[model samples]
Target: MLTNVPGYPRIGSGRELKKANEAYWAGTASLEKLQLTARQLRRQNWEAMQQAGIDLIPSNDFSYYDQVLDMCLMTGTIPARFKPLLERLASPQSLELYFAMARGYQKNGLDITAMEMTKWFDTNYHYLVPEFDTTQQYRLLSHKCVEEFREAKSLGIHTKPVIIGPLTFLLLGKIKDHSLHLHSLLEQLLPVYLQLLTALQEAGATWIQIDEPYLAMDLNPAIHQLYINTYNRIHQAIPGLQLLIATYFDALGDNLATALQLPVQALHIDLVRAPQQLTTVLQQLPAGMQLSLGVVDGRNIWKNDYQLSLALINEAVQAIGQDRVWISSACSLLHTPYDLDLEQDEQVLTREIKHWMAFAKQKLHEIADLAQIATGNNTSLAANMAAMQAKQHSPLIHKPAVKARVAALDESHATRKSPFHVRQESQEVAFQLPLFPTTTIGSFPQTAEIRQLRAQLKKGTISSEEYHQRIKAAIAETVKWQESLHLDVLVHGEFERNDMVEYFGEQLEGFVFTQNGWVQSYGSRCVKPPIIYGDVQRTHPMTVAWSSYAQSLTKKPMKGMLTGPVTILQWSFVRNDQPRADTTFQIALAIRDEVSDLEKAGIRVIQVDEPAVREGLPLRRANWDAYLQWAVQAFRIAVCSVLDDTQIHTHMCYAEFNDIIDSIAAMDADVITIETSRSQMELLEAFARFKYPNEIGPGVYDIHSPRVPTVEEMSSLLQKASTLLPARNIWVNPDCGLKTRNWPETEQSLRNMVAAAVQSRSAVLVN
Candidate 1:
């Protein structure tokens, strides 16, 4: 059997791409330097895969921004809005034009907000949403996949070029013309895919990995049939070209039969997520069709259980000969960190915990080793087996106190004191703000100076007291600025916090920090998700002091910000020994402790950000109910400790909550703030149709981009939102936190937002 990886991390070990991209954006580096950095990273990635004995290395997966955006460029899916920007640019083929589409462009009197970005599947990674129209044409705008394949060939590596499959691409996109449906463009779309495939065939590429992860989800019969037709047509068109249909993240239950019937050379199924599917796959797989058993967990940070994975792979090899079976990761390694050896926290993460962990590079080695073992060479398996055996008996993994606490949890621990309406009335009396209360989604900007101070604190160049003083000063300035804007609710500007989840993880017992484990969240914005190792417990108050201090400095209501249990669990590379729900519940209880402490310290308004909640929903609808039950319960467990008058607010960003409206209401947050600005109030339509009982803060400013919305634009969005729900039920805010943005844009955008809210409220009163 051959060893393969679906995809690899594009960000360099030290986030070299991030630094180079930022330098280019800031005019500190030449475009040539930026291109050289990208080329270097790509070459390094190819070389690493080749050296790891990967027979099927993937090319064209190294995206500067996102694969979805790359597909948009490749297929000429540019929206009409970006036409003016392209026309203004001297060179239309400039990467700046492409970057402008991913991130908004604002310079030299040209201002354009970027296209909307949403979470990719159930991960923290965000993708630029593809916008389509009736008149949209399809052509090979960028031969990125073909070019990358040639580059790899030049390095003596014959790699399989990866492309986002047609059906999945179409499903993720939206139609601009309300008169036409998204599927209607498939006739024009399919031809472009054929052209690209034919080009790859001409370029001497033998195998192409077409990722159709949507097949893993519960699909209607028609959509399942659509996949049969789509792949069949492509198969007939390119007779000699081999197509490998790749599906992961969940099991293909009903779609399994449809997938097997497709005319593809090979099929890849994730055994890590759905091991039960292995027996069925072995039974239904057609004669002479190759099977790629994805036995390694790609989305996790844990060491693969060599005994179990090898057993599964050996079963497949027994059914289909070893020549026809390939070994690969369950998903792309894009979800993991670089290398475990690169980790810095020896004292905290520890040798024992590190022994059981494997980052992306280590995972590649495991895949290689598994291939070797399956081929009857067990040299690498000996140490892996020993480590796995030792971990099973480790005392660090089994703690009585954490188990006792989890067993002690009851129904009462997950219930609030009152219903939302009663809580709303009391909260109204306690705060007494305007019809449209204006607030931020927490986190004012993290400036260069703030980052420098944090680095100083970490390096011991500055004392802890000095760090605290600087953070306090930053918070004071943010408070004064918000008050000047006449905002209703205020935040302390999370200057001391590095990340929303990482900050809380640092205060918790079971979590550990990394020095250089950054993963790309979106564009140049990278996040280092904390590693959750052992049983979680909170010993002391996490956010009380800073929240209490901020409230004391302000007359307006101050919101104590905390990352929710679900978001914390979803964002972090959590321990895989127990059920995910159990780990999530543990994290919830810890946050509950923090919530009670903050309420006791006089924080009347609290916002627990659960932006990852929707993103964490199971890919299969059949599995969503079970996942949501515990996920919602976890959120309730975290916030139920606070009184109704405390006004629990939960914030979600870059999510499509239409299908999960009932689930969102189930969380029972007094006022739920959603990310709607990028959608231009399109997301609010769900709540509008549902007539959602809870109050909402529908974001009016798109904080994801550098472009600041004009007062009129913000007012128009508020006007539209008011028409959807009662004006009194709607609050005004930005789409998400201001951490990724600069201070100037954050301030200007908030100023415009507040003014719009004031104007809209006045108009509502007039009506």
Candidate 2:
């Protein structure tokens, strides 16, 4: 049996790629210099995987931005808006155009909006969603995949080139014209894949791994047939080339039968998510076809149980001979950190938790070891099993106080003091605001000056008093701006914070901050997830001082922004010693303390963001109920401490609320704002159908892009939202925070947003 991984993290160990890309964007580094840095990182990643004894090392997975964006670049799927940037380019092929597509560009009086980005199938990672039109044409714009394959081949690694499957590419994309279908362009799309495959075959590649993760979702028969036809055509076109159709993130379910019918050489299924499918798969898989068994956990930081994984691999091998079974990771290592050894401080990570944990590097080694054990080479298996057993029984993991507190929890703790109607009346009386209140989703820009000041403070170059003065000044300035814009709700701009979760993690006990443990959240967006160890609790107020200070500056209500418990737990490198729910509840209690403290300090409108809650949903359907139950309870326990008049609010972004709208309502927040600007409020149909009984700020403009929305555009979205639900239930805000944006775009966007709110007031007041 051979060990294989579909992909690995493209961001370098110390975030070399992030630094390089930033320097290039800043005009400090040349394109050649940035390309050199990327080349070095990619070489290091391939070599690391190679050294781990991986037989089917993957190429073309590494991208400066996102893989989907790379595909867009390769297939010449450039939209018409980017034509100006391309025309002005000095070189025939400039990465500036690529970067423009990923992040919108504004230079020399030209402006272009970025394509929409959303959650990559229930993970924290985000991808650029493709946009297609009938007039969209495809060409071999770049030979990147073929070039990478040759590069790896020169380095003595005949790697399997990985590409996003055509079916998945079309499935994730939306049609530019509402009257057209994205799948209609599939005929044109298949040629690009076919040409790429022929090129890879010529580049000395024996096999190719086509990632089609969408197959795991609940696909309709038409979509399933599309998958079959797409693969069948490719298989027919490239008869000599071996193709492995890989699926991950969940079970194949009904798609299993369809997948088995494909004429590919092999099919990879995530045995880690749906282990029960192994028996059916082995029995039903046609003879002579290969089965790549994904047994290692690629999503979590926890170490694999070598014995259990080996047994599963053995079962597949027993059914379909060892020659036909390939052991691999359940999904890409894109979701995990690079290495555990980088976490040098044992006092923080601890030996106990460290023993139970595994990063990407360690995970690769686990896959190799599992392959060894499955192949009847148990040289080090017994020792690893003994160590695992000993760590499971470690006393350090079992915190008696934490367990007792969790067990003592009852329904009262997770419920609001009053119903939604009562809270709504009290909130209206407290604020006396007009319909369609205009507000931001917390945080203004985290400018370079702010980032530099923060770095100085961290390095002890600035005093605590000096930092506090700067933060207060920033908040005062933000309040002045909001007042100038005539916004109903204000925020402090979060100048005192570096990241939403890391700021709170620094104040709370049992959480350790990292200096360079950055993991890629999306394109050029790397987040250093705080390490949560031991039982969590609050020793002092986290956001009370900032929120209270901001409120003092404005007559308009300043929303107390805090990251929710579920979000904190989801965004952090959590402790694997106990159940995630236990860790989550502990985080909730800590947030509860902060919420109560904020309320006492005269902070009325609290906005706790749980953007990661939906992303944290388990991949499997059977496992979702248990996770959501605890996750919802955790969110409630954090904000339920306040009285009805306090007007508790929560914000969620990059989430699909349709499946969990009931749980969202269950949180009992007086107001809930979600990301809808990218989808143009398409996400709210579920809320409309369910009659979601709370105030909602379905975002009127997409903040993630640089192109500012016009007043008419924002007004049009709010008008559409008004048609869905009671107009009073609607609020106006940007899709997400403005931290990543510049001052110019943010100012224009908010001005337009306020105009849209004013225009929508009549609709809101009609009933």
Instruction: Show how many residue pairs clash in every candidate, following the order shown.
Output: 0, 0
Q: Which stretches of candidate 1 lie above 4 Å from their native place?
A: 89-92
TM-scores for every candidate against the unseen true structure: 0.98, 0.92
> In model 1, which residue pairs have backbone atoms overlapping below 3 Å?
none
lDDT of 2 by residue, 393-417 (tens): 7665556776778788888888888
Cα lDDT tens digits, model 1, 583-610, are 9988998999989999999999999999
lDDT of 1 at 137: 70
Candidate no. 2 TM-score:
0.92
Off by over 4 Å in 2: 80-94, 107-110, 178-183, 461-463, 576-579, 618-627, 723-727, 755-767
Which candidate achieves the best TM-score against the true structure?
1
Single out the weakest 10-residue window by summed lDDT for candidate 2. 346-355
Tell me the lDDT of model 1 at 729: 87
Local accuracy by lDDT, each model:
0.89, 0.85
